[model samples]
Target: MSDKDVAEDRAANADMRSAFDTSAAGPRPPSEITGHYSSDNPDMVQFVDADGNRLETTEANAPYAQIVEDMTSQDAREIYRDLVLVRRIDAEGHALQRQGELGLWPSLLGQEAAQVGAGRALKPQDYAFPGYREHGVAWCKGVPPENLLGMYRGVNHGGWNSNENNFHLYTIVIGNQMLHATGYAMGVQTDGDVATGDPERDTAVMAFTGDGGTAQGDYNEALVFASVAAAPVVFFVQNNQWAISEPNEKQFTIPPYQRSRGFGIPGVLVDGNDPLATYAVSVAALDRARSGQGPTLIEAYTYRMGAHTTSDDPTKYRSDAEVEIWREKDPIKRMRGFMEERGHAEPDFFDEIDAEADEIAARIRHACQTMPDPPQEAMFDHIYAEPHPVTERERAEFVEYQESFVQEGAH
Candidate 1:
C-alpha cells in the first residue's frame, strides 16, 4: 500500500487504541458508571438530604443502602451521640486555642459526619493513618479527646499508642499518611491477614486526607504503590470543598473520587454531611478491601465550616453567605432533625445529650488549664527506641544549659 493511502486510512479511522488497553471501550464498571461531578446528573451517594429526609436509593447507592438498612435505631442513636460529642470536643479545642491554652487547633466544625462516619465503620483491628485534622476519627478510634489535644497543645509529640487503637499519630505534613497506610496494608497482606474469609481475621487499613492533600505528589505515589500491590486500604478524602484558602476550582478540574479510576481503583462520592451516607459507603468500601478487592477511594463531599486553623481567617477568602448556606446543612443538625422526625429519639434524650456535652466541655476546659508542661529534658527522651549517643549528648547539653540559668540566679 502507498504511504499516502495508509496515512489517509488511519486519519479516516480516527480511533486510537493503545496496545496496553484491557478494558474495551464498552460498558463501564458499576463503580465507574457515575460520571464526574455535576448538579444536574449528581451521583453523590446519599441516604439522607439536608432537610432530614431519607432519600430513595438509586443503582449507585443500592448496595450502600442495604448497609444503612441493616443499621438499627440504637445504632443511629449511638452515631448521633458520637456526632454530638465530637462536635463538642472540636468546639472545646477551638475555644482553648482562642484562650491561649493550645498552640493551635484545626477546627473540624463542619465535618463531624465525614470523620465520625468513616471512624465508626472501622473494625478494631483495622489500622488507620490520619492527617492532623481527623479529630473525629481519633475520637471514634477510642483516642481520648484530650489525647489528641496534647500534640496540638505542644505538650507532647503524640500521646496515644497506635497499637492500642490501630490509629497512627497524626501526620501534619499533608498527604504523607497515604504512603504509611499503603505500606502497612501491604504488610497486612504479607501476614496473610487479608482475604482469609474470616471476617474478624481479615484486616484493612485506612488513610485520611483532605481535598487539598489529593494534590500532593505523595498521595499520587501511594496510589500507584497500592494499585500494584493490591493493598487492603481505603483512601478517604474529605473534600470539604476547600484546601485551606483554595477552593475546588483552584485545586483540580477533576474531583478525587473521579480521579481514582485512573489508578485502577474503584471510587465513590458521598454526601459528607450525611453520616448515614458516609457510614454506609465506608462499610461497603471496607468490606471490599477485606474481600481481597484491594484499595478503594472514597470522596466525602462535605465543607469546611470553620477556619483552616486557629491562624486562618476564612473570611478573607470565602463569603459569609456561603458559610451560612453550609451551616444550614450542618451534620449534627440534620442528624438530630432526622431522629426527631422519625421519633427515634425523644425530646428529653436530646436535652440530656446537650447537658452531658456541657459537662464534657467544662471538663475539657479544666484539663487544658491544668495540663502540666513537660520538662525541657523530655525533648530528648524518645528519639530512639535504643540509646543513641547523639540524643544523649543533646540531653546533656540541655541539662547544662538549664543548670547555667540556675547558677546565674544564685550568683
Candidate 2:
C-alpha cells in the first residue's frame, strides 16, 4: 500500500480495535478508574492530643474551647457527674435487656465524650434529633434516666415528651432523624427564628446519627435539603467505626466528613474520644448553623467499644486487638486526664464523683426494676391527635381481655 493509504488503514484499524475492546482485561484496572469518597481522615481538625494536652489555635478557632474552659467548676463537676450517672444507667438498661426486661438496649459505653460534649453545647431553645443510642445526650438534655430506661423496658413507646425537653424521640430507623431535623430547621428559617442576628431568639437543630446511618439515603438527602435551603441544622455523625458487624471501611472508601464537599457544606472530623474536642467542634457547627450559615457535617471519630446493641456480639466480626486499641482512647479516661492535668478537678473530686456514681447506679437499678408497666388503656391514648372510634374499640377490647385474665379468687 502507499504511505497515505497505510496510515489511513492503521487509523481505521485502531478505531475498530477500540470499538471491540469490551473484554474484562483492559489498559487500566476498574478499581483504578473508580473514584471514592473517604469516611475517615486522620489529618482533619484535632484539638486535643492523645496525651490530654490542648492544642493552641487562633482566636477565631477558639470559641468552643474557650466556652468549655470557661465552664464553671460547678458545671465541670456536673458534666462529670452526668457522664458517670448516664453510664451506669446505660449499663443497667443493658443488663435489663439481657434479663428479658427490655426488647433491646443500645449501649453507649465508649461514646460518652461525643454525646456529652455535643449535648451540653446546645442552647435551651435548640432542638435535638437523636438516634436510639443517644442516652447520654438525652441525659444532658435534662431527660430523666428513668424516662430512658422505661422505653427499653417496654413500658412506653418513649417515656418523655419531645416538646417538653426540646428533644425528639429515640429514632430506631437509621438516618431518619436527619430529615426530621432538616425539616425542623427549615421551619425555623421560615418562621424567622434564625437569621435575625439575635443569638437568643435564633435557633439551630442538631441531628445525631452513626457511621452506619451515614450510608442511608435519608442522611444524604438531609444534607442536600439542608444545603439547598440553607437550613440552620447541624448534621452530627458519630463515626463509632461499626454498624453492627460491618466496619466503617465497608461503608465508605474515604472519610465521611469529606462527603460534605459534594453537598456544598463544610465537614469537620474531630477526635470523638476527646470530650473537649467534640464539644468544641459541635459547638462551632451549631453556632454557625444558628448564625444562618447553613448546615455542617461533623464526623466525630469515635469507636464503638461495645456491641452495636445488646443482642449483637462484636467478637464474631471484630478482633480483641481492635477493641483493645480503642479502649486506650476511652472518652471518660481522656476527659479525666485532661481535667487532672489542667487542675480542673482533683483526686478528692474524683473520689466524690465515684461515690456519687455508685449512688446513681443503685438508684437507676431500683428505678428500672420498679418502673410500672403502662396501663392497657395507655396504648390507645397517643395513637392519634384526635380520638378514633376503631382504636377506641380496640382499646376497649384490650382492656377487657386484660381484665378477663384476672382469676375469680384474685382481689
Candidate 3:
C-alpha cells in the first residue's frame, strides 16, 4: 500500500478510538472509591466461613456445597496440606529474594487456597496459562518449586517443561496469557476435545489473572472470542484487593465475576480464602467447559498480604489495619481451624505438616542457592532459526569482555 493509504488508515483508527473515549468523566473520589473486601456480598459462595464453622450455604451457593459434601475427609486433608506448603513456598521465595539469592520474586502470600483449589481441579489433559504469581498452581500441577526459581533468579526463561505438566510458561505481560489460553481452548474445540462424552478425551483450558488484569484490552478481547467460539476455558481472576499499589477502584466499578455475564458467559464469586469453596466452584466451571458450555469467569475474592513484589512497599498505599483484617482470614489458618473444629485431622497430623513444610522450604532454599547459570550464548539461541551476523557479533564481544575481566584479575 502507498504511504498515503497507510496514513489514511491510521487516521481512521484514531478517529474510531476517539469516539469511545471516556476521559472526561474524571476519577472517583477517595471516599467513594470502594473495594471488594469491605462488604460481605451475600451471593458469594462459601462452604466454610472465616471463623471455622461449616458455613450454611446460600441458595446461590448450595450446588457447590453439594459438590464439596461429596469430597471425602482425605480430600479436605490434602487441600489443607497444599495450603500450608504453598504458603511456605511463598515465604521462601520472598526470603530468597531478600537474601540476594534470587533477582526478584512475586509473593502469592495470601492466595494459596485460590491457586491450590483451581490448580487441583485441572485434569491431566487440561492446560493452564498463568500470570507471574502462580507458584501454588505450579506446585499443584507437579512443577518442582525449584523450577520456578530459575525465572526469578535470572538463570533461565522458566525451569520446567510446560508440556510435561500442561502448564504454560508464566506470561509476564498482564492479560496476554488470557488470549493464549483462549486460542488454545479454541483449538481444543476445533479438535473435537470438548463435549466429547468421554472424560478422558474432553479437555478444557484455564486462564489466570488478577482483578486488575480485567481492565486490559487483551483480557476483554479474549473473553469476547472465547464466548463467541464456545471455547472450553475458565478465567480465574484472583482479586487480591490491589492491582500492584492501585486498589479495585482504579480498575472497574463492578467485580470481575459480575462483568463476565455481559460477555455472554457465567460468572461466580467465591470466598477465595475458603479452599473447599474455591475447589467446588472451579470443578463446576471446568465441568461446564468440558460439557461445551463455553467459558466461566471466577473471581477469587482474596487479598495481597505482602508487597506486590519484593521491590514494592505495601505501606505506601495500603494500611496495616487493612492487612491485619485479611491476615485473620488467611487460608491456611482458616482451613486449620475448620479442620480442627470438624475433627478432620489429629494434632499429630498438624505436626507432620509443619515438619514437612520446613523440610520442603529447606530444599527450595538449597536449590535456589546452588542452581547453575545458563551458558552465556544460551541467551541468543532461540531468537531466530538461524544465527544472524549481528547476534554472532554480540556473542563474540560479550565473551571477549568477560575474558578481559579475568585477565585483569590474573595480573
Question: Evaluated with lDDT, which candidate comes out highest?
Answer: 3
Q: What's the TM-score of each model vs. the native?
A: 0.90, 0.85, 0.88
Looking at candidate 2, what is the lDDT of residue 76? 64
Candidate 2 — which pairs collide? Answer: 37-254, 38-254, 38-255, 39-254, 39-255, 39-256, 40-255
Give RMSD (Å) of candidate 1 vs. truth.
7.8
lDDT of 1 by residue, 289-376 (tens): 9889999999997888889999999988877777777788899888988888887888888888888899989987888788899998
Judging by TM-score against the true structure, name the best candidate: 1
Model 3, span 1-411: residue lDDT tens: 799987975774464344333455864333234333333556588877776778775876888877888988798799999999999999999999999998889999989999999999999999999999999899999989998988899888677889999999999899999999999999998899999899999999999999889999999999999999989999999999789988775687666886787799898988899888899999999999999999999999888899999999999987776777787888888888888998899999999999999999999999889989898868867687887998889989988888999999999
TM-score, ranked from best to worst: 1, 3, 2
Q: Is candidate 1 or 3 superior in TM-score? A: 1
Summarize candidate 2's per-residue lDDT along 134-220 as a digit string, tens digits.
Answer: 998898898888888888788987879999889999999999999999999999998999878887899999999999998999998
Clashes of 3: 0
Model 1 earns a TM-score of 0.90
Q: Which stretches of candidate 2 lie over 4 Å from their true place?
A: 1-42, 56-75, 407-411
Which RMSD values do the candidates have, in order? Answer: 7.8, 9.3, 8.4
Q: Count clashes in each candidate, considering only residues at least 3 apart in sequence or on different chains.
A: 0, 7, 0
Ranking by lDDT: 3, 1, 2
